[model samples]
Target: MFDWLQHIADWLVYDVFNLSTEQHLANALNFFIYDTVKILILLFVIIFFMGIVNSYFPVDKVKNYLSRHKLYGLEYLMASLFGVVTPFCSCSSVPLFIGFVRGGIPLGVTFAFLITSPLVNEVAIGLFIGLFGLKTTLIYIVSGILLGTISGVILQHLKLERYLTPWVKDVLAQAQREQHLFEAEQLAFKQRLPIIWAEVKKILKGVIPYVVLGIAVGGLMHGYIPEGFFEKYMSKDNLFAVPVATILSVPMYSNASGILPVVQVLVSKGIPLGTAIAFMMGVVGLSLPEAMLLKKVMSLKLIAVFFGIVTLCIIISGYVFNVIL
Candidate 1:
């Protein structure tokens, strides 16, 4: 199947399209444009439905149910599982975080949701399945959720609630200010569709540039990078590969969906699956943007702690996958 697809790809580029050196460059440009357009369309449809779900459902109910303080482990599991179904990015997760905080959910459980939401989203899962097959995708999903739950429970045990910014705490305290704001606004579902559409537009405006840049870079690396370069740096035999990948991925920002294709190429070139997976997770979950955004609600100390915990989790997950797979 892959050979057939590659044959078609070659025919289109080398025969019908007659791509020369200059044409290859143009084709690359066109690839980026097409990729950006496709990703924007997908994001719009997915987020529109998510917005409707957010508006119609009582998010407070989930918060309240999870806040009862009965079973920390179970609550963490549920939070992580919930994240798998919800399609939210770091920015989108903020409002839900605020709602969870205002609804009196435990700080640790809320952190679980925050961690899992970006790391193990449906789009990421689908892309993984398509690129890497079911086994690898399942490993990614399971490890991500495990990391979220474990990190949340650990943070709760540390009692680091005091590290939150004072203003954020105040926002939680003033929860009644906008309670029922959505419920009181009476609009038919059809009428509400436009609002969701507008949100999709705004989000795409912000996200498209990053997606374009990331994919273009990935395509260049895919087409031109030396096959053995990543293999030499990130082979299973290299003890330092996992941690190195995690550290290198910190400044970079791409979700799993954006990184999966690049990762497929890396694996084909003999890069260890564990190292590639760790790099992908770090890019999505521990980005500079996420850290900066989190600073609005947390002190530098808390942000540092969050990064450290996630980095450690990714490293450990890498090693585990290396051993098992």
Candidate 2:
């Protein structure tokens, strides 16, 4: 399957178009533009619909009901599902985390939402589905949710609640007052278009730079990175490769959409699927930016612990996949 896809991609780039270096660069730029546009469109559409749902649905009531339940498994499932639907980035997630904590949700459960929301977002999922097959995409999504839930539960059990910043606790106290407020006059769907567009513009402004950077890195890897490099260091036969890849990817941040092409190159060149997937997961979910953002609400100890746990989980996942497939 991978070989077939690679053949097609190769044909598209080299045979049909006969692209030169300049043309390859142009193609790279075109890919960046295409990816950015697609992500922006998906973000706007999903968030706009989320806004409409927020306006009409009784979220508070639902949250209140869910908060009464103490089943950690169920809570994790719900939190993961919530993540799939919420249109939030890592930075934006702090506010929602604050709200969840203030609303009396367990810290572990909140973490589940925080981790999965940005890492396994709809736009990322859509891109993965398009680039990889359905099986790999589904596995990625399920793994993200499961990781979030298990991590959350483990944190809760560790009693790390004391590691939260004092300010975070204080902020949680105001959750009751931070209710959503909509205009008294309800706007029709047609009227909502402009409002949604403005919100979309705001989101695009924040994401465009990161998207560009991700694409630039991807383009370089696609066109110039040596196939032998991956084979030597990241091959399935290399026992240390999984952990090494996981560690190396932690400081970087890029979603599957941006990384899939790079993963394709790696897999084509003999990198292990598990190692590559683990690297991608680490990059997407346990990034430097996420750690910095989390610092605002957590102590150094908490952040270190969170990172350690997720990194361990990713390594295990990689090894597991390696053994199974």
Candidate 3:
């Protein structure tokens, strides 16, 4: 499927630019061209398709359903799965997190959505399939869902709702949802196209920079980093690799799509798949910026607890993946 892209890369690098395949610059440029174009194409198609799905199943519905139902712990899984369709990064998921809080959904269920929304989404899924193939992508999706669900359940048991700001408490007391927003949406498919297309464009605009930047960095690593450079620290044999990778990722922030190319490069550079994936998860799901955003609604202790729990889960997942893959 991507052979044509390879041909273009070869032609541009070898035939047009007249650079040898052996040259580092040629390799980097080729990787950059192929990955950037491929990822963007996949991202566009997936986002547009998911936008249609999202139009039919709005966030309001998810909120209402979860709020109204008693799913015997299945609700956390449902919320995490919903995150897959949302295509939000950790930062972008904040407003929806606020919405879930205001909707009176249990804080744990909300945490499930917030945790997975950024870590695994349609955008990242499309990119993952292109970058990592099906087997790895399947593992990633399942791991992401499990991470969110487990984290949500753990946090729920802690009863962190008490740590919510007084503002959220007041809002809960006077809760009023704008259900009217979707009340008149019986439009034809064609009628919804423009709105969906606009959203597709907006999302693409918001995400393109990160994708390109990540691929650029990946391209450099693919071309210039010595094989086994990353293995020195993150190899499977390294006992501290997974936790170190997870901890190191907290300060960095990027969406899954944006960080995936780098993750691919890490795998290629001899880093264990689990460690590399954990690092990606950490960066996407647990950034400090996300903490600052949560501070408006959550106390410092709650934020710390949330981050701590997710971090531990991610680290454990890293080890599991290492053993499995």
Candidate 4:
């Protein structure tokens, strides 16, 4: 199906520019061209459909279900699953987090949703399948959901409600008293087009720079990195490799789609599959931008705890995959 697209890229690079694909510079340019076109096309189609689905599912209903449930295990599970479909970026996820907290949802359950939303975005899943195949894609999805669910359940058990920011506690208390409810507004079918278009534009604007940067870095790594660089340092036999990858991923700002190309190159160059996957998850699931955004509503201590727990889980997952795979 994609043969024609590859032909077009090849034609432009080889025929038009007279550049040989065997050259490192030409290879990098071809990588950039193919990935940019493919990702942008996927982004537009998937995000547009996601917008339509999101519009149909009113936030009030979502909040009500999540908040009213006291069944901790079930709620966490549901929140993690719900996150798979929501596909929110880090900044947008914050408002939903606030609403969840305000609606009296447990912090842990809300955190579950927050963790999975970006990690389990449809675009990421689709790209993973395309780039890494089905088994790896399933591993990513299942592990991502499990991470969110387990982290949320642990936080709930620890009774960490007191660790929230003072303002968040105040808001929650006020919400409990006032019991403000969200009323669902039904929009006409035609009205939905503009909403979807706006969302598509907003999403594209936010992600384009990261996508470009990620592809550029990936292109360079694909073309120019020494073949044995990762094999020497990040092989499965290196006990510290998983931990290092997990730690490095936390501060990275790129989304899963942005970083997958580089990860592909890393794995092709002989980085352990588990280590590469761990790094990809870290970048997508936890980031400096996400922490800064969450800071508005969470105490610094709580943020630290959240980051620590997630990092630990990712490291464990990496090691397990390394041993098993």
Candidate 5:
């Protein structure tokens, strides 16, 4: 189906361009071209469909339903499950988080959605199933859900509502007053198409730069870095490997699909499965970009607490996987 893309990539790198296939620079550039194209295609298609689905669930109704439910556990679970289908990265999910807050959903429930959205995307799940088989994929998905749910429950118990930026409360208050003013009509298919396109464009503009930069770094590491480095530091025998991997992943930003190629390399090079998976989760679950976007709505203290809880859970999950798998 994408034979033309493959041919164009090959021609650009090796035939028309006359670059040597064996050179490190050529290989890196080729990988960059190929992966960038494929990922962008996936991103556009996924975002468009997600936009269409979201159009059906108006913010006011979502807020009304979620807010009315006092069952914290069920609410968290529902949020996490919704996160799986939406499959947005943390930065991109920020807008959705704002909407959730505007709808008057509990802070903890919003956190659950934010926490799971990036980690449990459909693309990541599909890729994992292809690479590691169903059993391991199930393990990863279940662990992600549990992590989001538990962390959310803890944060809820902390009662950190005041930690939201004042602007969020102001917006929520405004939204509340406006809720009774107009009932949202179901969007016609034609109307939904424009909304989907707009969403795709907006998300692409925000995410492409991060995706490109991340791929460049990963490409360099893939082509230039020696495999022995990971073997020495992240091997199963290294007691600190899990925590170390988790810590290292926090600053780097990449989607799960974007980072899986690097994770595959790490695992193949004798890095423990648990450590490699931890690193991937760290990138997907938390990053500097996500933090920056979140700063618009969350105080520094709340952000710190959120990351701390998530980090602890990921570390524990890594250890458990290492022991069992």
Candidate 6:
């Protein structure tokens, strides 16, 4: 499917620049150009498609639906799946997380969405397809959903509502007093195009930097890094590799768009796929920036507990992937 992109990269590297295939710089530049264009195209298409979905079923509607419906235990699953389609990064998802809470969604359910949104979404799905192919992407999506659902359910059972800050308590009380507001008047499909297009552009604008930086970092690694360099630390033989990678990644932050290409490079360098993926999940899902944003709504203890559950889930997932893949 991406054969044409490879052709373009080869032409630019060899024909236009007149660099030989043996040159590392040529290989790096080729990797960058091919991946950049391919990922951008994939991201643009998926974001625009999701934008239309979001417009039809706006945030207000989703909030109301989840708040009203019991959905049995599946509410957690629903929230996690919703997180997959939404394009918000870790920090960005927190505001919506607050919205869900204020709208009376279960705190654990919101946690499911919050945990998954950053780790897997439209942008992440697209990049995963590009970097790891369909099979791995499907596994990743399922694992993300499961991780969020499991974390949310466990947190819900903990009865941690009191752990919320006083400000959030007030917000929740105010929301209870307010009446439900229905959607605005519907517009023609043609009228909605502009709004959706604007959203598509907005999403692309926000994530493009991450994509480019990630791919650039990946290209350098691809071209110049010695094979098996990372394997020494993260290879499958190392039982603790997954946990170490997951823990090390917590301090770093990047959305899926930025971190996925680097993940691709890690896999190429012989790091166990599970370990690399676990590191990527930690960076995106358990980022320090996300914790800072959560501080506004949740107490420090609540945030710590949330991070703890997610960290454990990610580590488990990493090990599972290493064994299977």
Highest-lDDT candidate: 3
Q: Candidate 3 — which residues are off by over 4 angstroms?
A: 1-69, 176-232
Worst lDDT run of 10 residues, candidate 3, spans 174-183
Flag the better candidate by TM-score, 3 or 4: 3
**Candidate 3 at 122: error in angstroms?**
1.5
lDDT for model 5, please.
0.74
**TM-score, every prediction:** 0.65, 0.63, 0.64, 0.63, 0.68, 0.64
Write model 4 residue lDDT over 165-282, tens digit each, in one string: 7766654443332222111345576766775676467556755665566566655655665433433556666779998887866655455676788788888878888899888777
Candidate 5 lDDT by residue in tens digits, 1-325: 4568867888899987788987777776776676567656766765565455445544566757855766748888888889999867666566667656655667888899989999998899999998888998999999999888888888888999999888667655544433332225544677557645754575567557755765565455445544334445577678999998888777666678877887888887778788998988888898775676666678999999999999999999999888788
Off-target runs (Cα >4 Å) in candidate 1 are: 1-69, 176-232
Report every candidate's CA lDDT. Answer: 0.69, 0.65, 0.78, 0.71, 0.74, 0.76
Clash counts per candidate, in order, are 0, 0, 0, 0, 0, 0
Question: RMSD, model 1, all Cα superposed?
Answer: 7.4
**Which model is ahead, 3 or 6, in terms of lDDT?**
3
Model 3 alpha-carbon miss at residue 232, Å: 6.1
Point out where model 6 deviates above 4 Å: 1-70, 177-233
Residue-level lDDT of model 1, residues 1-325, one tens digit each, is 1244445555666677677645545455444444444445555655555556655654465556656546738988898898878776554455466546545567888889988987898888888888878998888888999999999999888888899888556654433322344568867787767765665565456555555565566445334443334445677667899998888777555556667777788788777888888877776777665565556568999889888988998899988987887
Enumerate residue pairs that collide in model 2. Answer: none
Superposed Cα deviation of residue 161, candidate 2 (Å): 1.2
Candidate with the larger lDDT of 5 and 6: 6
Per-residue lDDT over 161-180 for candidate 3, one digit per residue giving the tens place of the 0 to 100 score: 99998866754443222123
Give the Cα error of residue 26 in candidate 4, in Å. 24
lDDT rank order: 3, 6, 5, 4, 1, 2
Residue-level lDDT for 316 in candidate 3 = 95
